[model samples]
Target: MGNLSRLLKESWTLVEEQQDKVAGYFYARMFLSNPELRDLFPTQMDVQRARLLGAIVTAVQTMEDPDRFEEYLQSLGRDHRKFHVEPQHYDLVGNALLEALRTFAGERWNIEYDQAWRDGYAVIAKKMMAGAAADTNPPYWNAEVLAHERRSRDIAVFTCRPFYPLDYRAGQYLSIEVPKYQPRLWRVYSMANAPRPDQTIDFHVRALGAGYVSGALVRRTRPGDLIRLAAPMGSMSPDHSSNRDVVCIAGGTGLAPVKAIVDELSRYNRTRWVHVFFGARDRDDLYDLADLNAMANKYPWLTVVPACSDDPGFDGEQGNISEVIARYGPWNDHDFFVSGSPAMVKATMRTLAGLQVPSIRIKYDAFTDG
Candidate 1:
């Protein structure tokens, strides 16, 4: 690692454990320093605070991959346009971030760390600014809900059509805002199917504890409702260049992106095989099993395995999905796409690592809008 990456990482360790406090200090500093900028954020800062730390962690993690780092930051910049972020806002953010780190790091922080952060933040801001400037698309798209189906008490599947041409890969995720329920609060969900010419997109949402956006989306959203969609961001799409068989591990609503990716694969795949392991806590939670089975039936190259962890009566695979995957594998040669709750994703990734699957062969979608 370069000196700058090393310094930034080592310094971050000091405050990483106290993430909440560091994030608290960050927003406190920003709002105190520039109270006017507070208008750009939602009234509920909990999700925003988590996203702040998540973004930093992502930036730090991707620093080793220059191409990925630049692409992700640029996409983030374009996505942040909906927040009305401007060139001056980046300056304010940098100042607040540095102050937050310095406050949390206490005596452990020093000149070298400070310089490394300044230089790193400068690069990050520059790339984000460039992305924002280069983007010609609108800050957000006007989407009209065309279909809404309740699959369970907490889960709903909804489809929307953007008024504009919403260009996105099948496996990317987009943030949605329902102005009626929560105007400023936005939550992200994966595209549930491949891109189609009709410009329709699907999302599966499971309401979390006290999740305003998710609750509204599941219980209240209906056909003909108007919602806002932000630009799609993520790189966990199909890597067609390799043409290797792929395995998709999905739990609950995480099935959305995996379904989208499989849809994309269906378009051109002839030689490669695809295996989908859909898991939920119980049979009731396997809400999309029928649909996935239908897709598998239609596609000759596809295989669907539904597993339930807590439902003893489930006749198919019936353990943690990762454990089930291990029984089916020796999958070191296959590309891996994983999506689920953070805990589920972590456990699955750990299992894959234990099997000696190359880290480069695995791609996981990790985000919790709830």
Candidate 2:
């Protein structure tokens, strides 16, 4: 490992136990040093602190692979532009980060550790600035909600039309900022349809406990509501060039991107067999079954299977989605896509691996939140 990486990993192990404290200290120091910068962030600091710490940990873990680490940093920088982050802000953040580390390290702090952190932060800042400079598109697109349907008590599907053309492939996600919910607070949602000629996008949102943005999106937002969308990101799109059959496993709202991919396939009249296994807690949770069934009826190449984990009286596939998938497969030769809560995705991936599916044949977005 590189010296900087080693130093960061060592220091991180010590500070991780007090992550909340370190993040609070960092933000407090930053706001104190530059009070003018406080307005850039949301009023709620709890989620913000967790996000900041999580990003740092992810960057540190990716340090061993320079290419991936650089790409990750650049993407992060480009995404931050939507929040009106500027070059000068990077300097302020870097300084605050170093100070927090020093405060936490106390007796463990030394010149070598300080220099290493400085060096690492320099790379991150430089790449992020470069990424910002290279972007030609608008920082964010303003979209108006055209329609909203309450699919269930907890889930809502929204169709929005952006003022400008929002170009994105199937299975990509966009970060949306709803001003009415909490101005400047952004949350990621998968685009639930393939590219439409009218530049209309669809999002499926499920409100979980204390999900401030999601609750507002599901229950408060209505037609004519304006929302800001960041650039489309994620690498979970289908490999169009591959002729192999596909197996998709989706749990809950994880079905969004899978449906998008299926829609795209239908548009192209793809001949390769496509099987989708949709899982939910019970029959009532299968909010999109009608849509899926309609798609299956129209597309000869697509098949939809609904599974329930908790309903004993349900007639369809009964079990966890991963377990049900394992029952149907010798999925060794098929391309696999799994999306769901983190635990579901992880378990599905393990199941696929046990079936001897090649790692390259399995594609998923690991960054999605439940």
Clashes of each: 0, 0
**After best superposition, candidate 2 residue 299: deviation in angstroms?**
1.4
Clashing pairs in 2: none
What TM-scores do the predictions have? 0.97, 0.93
lDDT of each: 0.90, 0.86
Tens digits of per-residue lDDT for model 2, 180-259? 77787888888989998888888888988877788889999999999999977776888888889989889988999999
Candidate 1 residues 1-370, lDDT tens each? Answer: 4778888899999998998998998999999999999998888887778786678678877888899999999998989999989999999999999999999899999999999989988988898889999999999999999999999778999999999998999789988888998888888899999999999999999998989899999999999999999989999998889878899999889999999999999899998899999999998889999999999899989999999999999899989998899999769689999999898899999999999999999999966636
Global lDDT of model 1 = 0.90
Worst 10 residues of 1 by lDDT: 48-57
Runs in model 1 with CA error above 4 Å?
none
Distance from true position, residue 362, model 1, in Å? Answer: 1.4
Best by lDDT: 1
In candidate 1 the C-alpha lDDT for residue 205 amounts to: 95
